[model samples]
Target: MPAVTVSNPLALPRLPEPGLDARPRPVLAVTTAPSGVEGEGFPVRRAFAGVNQSHLDPFIMMDQMGEVDYQAGEPKGTPWHPHRGFETVTYIIDGTFVHQDSHGGGGVITDGDTQWMTAGSGLLHIETPPESLVMSGGLFHGLQLWVNLPASDKMIKPKYQDIRGGSVKLLASEDGGALVRLIAGGIGGYEGPGITHTPITMTHVSVNPGAQVTLPWRSDFNALAYSLAGSGSAGIERRPFHLGQAVVFGDGDSLTIRADEVQDSRSANFEVVLLGGQPIREPVAWYGPFVMNSHRELQQAMEDFQAGRLGTVPTS
Candidate 1:
């Protein structure tokens, strides 16, 4: 195992914007009431890739896991599964998860930790609650997002980025009422540690009551903000967003978000994950865990998986 490199927070280049006075993007649409489905064994709320919608271009799917109080002995977690031609980004908000992949990569991701795995070529992996946590029974919450690779790089190579909570760069608003954690892109001049195959911005934001932050974004990329906790208004439209809602933005060079008054001490802050990337704009043939450009490629992926060519996790 190699030591994870942490980028100097002060040396991060700011995300460039064409104009400082550019108008903020408007709210294009709000997606709420995500479809509920059981994944592997645990429950999940899928924002995209549901029966109603699929493939947000460069992005394949987004799932909010648990957020449920699991009683002791409840069946939980995703067992061994195969994936190809895409990347899986897992951000742990609460609880601990153990991950193991066929490539002999395995580790635990605790609160605020992130696991970015590229299933390029192909691989088998399993994500489950650690034995200690499962026996104790507690609250579990997190987000799992799937990012697509361009056809040219779909089978480049497999890679893993295990980001610890303390290593993530945190940028604070001048007023100290807001903080942005860069997970896989530039935000407020601080760049995240994870290297991405596709250009994208992935951030976790926390805003105190009545505080606001305006951040620059590329106009050519597709952007979305998912409210994880509390309530707030987003974009130029000032559209109100609540927990479990995802707001998609229209074209613009920037976006604004403001935290509303807290209802109580428990809900004194608002949190959201902001993400965007240029669209791949390519044909997609998705089946189960494999996402390819055509049906023939999808069939090949299955064949490879059945033949055990994807490798196996070492037992020792």
Candidate 2:
């Protein structure tokens, strides 16, 4: 759960506190992620499984990959796959992952690092544990978020960004009760390193026990909070949320999160990922591996992929 951390949060820039008139976001709904197996039989929690698409505009789906400790010879990874009309943001929190793509954009990302891959036109890629990590077998936990590309940019050039842990913009709650790692987008004029086709904000937060954090949010952007560890409450109403639960927030100028006085033994702090994005509000034709604006486009993507127009896996 060490996505990013510091010995003393007070040493960081203090996050802007909400104004007195700030409207607290209301908790609209909460959904507990369902566990299932993903590529190569690795466990994952489907973070957006039961959430409404409208609330997740500009974002397709998210997978909380393994909070598991794999033994030697047990580590697994995804086989080569193709994607188009979207971007994949893979953030590694506890382990190392090696990424390779047909576009020659790939690298090794470990603790607190991120790999942002835009399969704009199309590309073949694979994600796997590094040989060393696979052999040693240790903690592996991360998040993969699918960000949809708007129709106009769906066919643009593909690209990649390797965002290192240290590149994240770190901030502390107004009272220094929480640590925030801004991976992408802006929060109160502070921007992250991730460059995206769609407007969005992605952050990992760690709230100390009994602490509360209030963050100003763009009213036009839909807000969401997914618990990564420990117990906490969301919104000004104090709606309870726990690990693997996704909290959808209603319209407001800001959002709130509170950590329980006593956290579960598994985690020392309440960990959550806050996500928000400007709604694309376009028709989505999403199938396995491809996301498009229309079913016909999805069909074209399949044709292109099968015909090897998406690029072949490198022989090397």
| The best candidate in terms of lDDT | 2
| TM-score list, all predictions | 0.89, 0.99
- Residues 114-163 of candidate 1 have per-residue lDDT tens digits of 99999999999988888888788877778899999999988977889999
lDDT of each: 0.78, 0.94
The runs of at least 3 residues in candidate 1 whose Cα sits more than 4 Å from the true structure, single-residue gaps closed, are 1-20, 49-55, 264-267, 313-316
Q: Every model's Cα RMSD, please?
A: 4.6, 0.7
lDDT for model 2 comes to 0.94
Which lDDT tens digits does candidate 2 get at residues 185-242? 9887789999988999999999999999999999999999999899999998999999
Cα error, residue 207 of model 1, in Å, equals: 1.3
Cα miss at 75, model 1 (Å)? 6.2
State, as a TM-score between 0 and 1, how close model 1 is to the true structure: 0.89
TM-score, structure 2 vs. true: 0.99
| Candidate 1 residue pairs in clash (backbone atoms < 3 Å) | none
Worst 10 residues of 2 by lDDT: 262-271
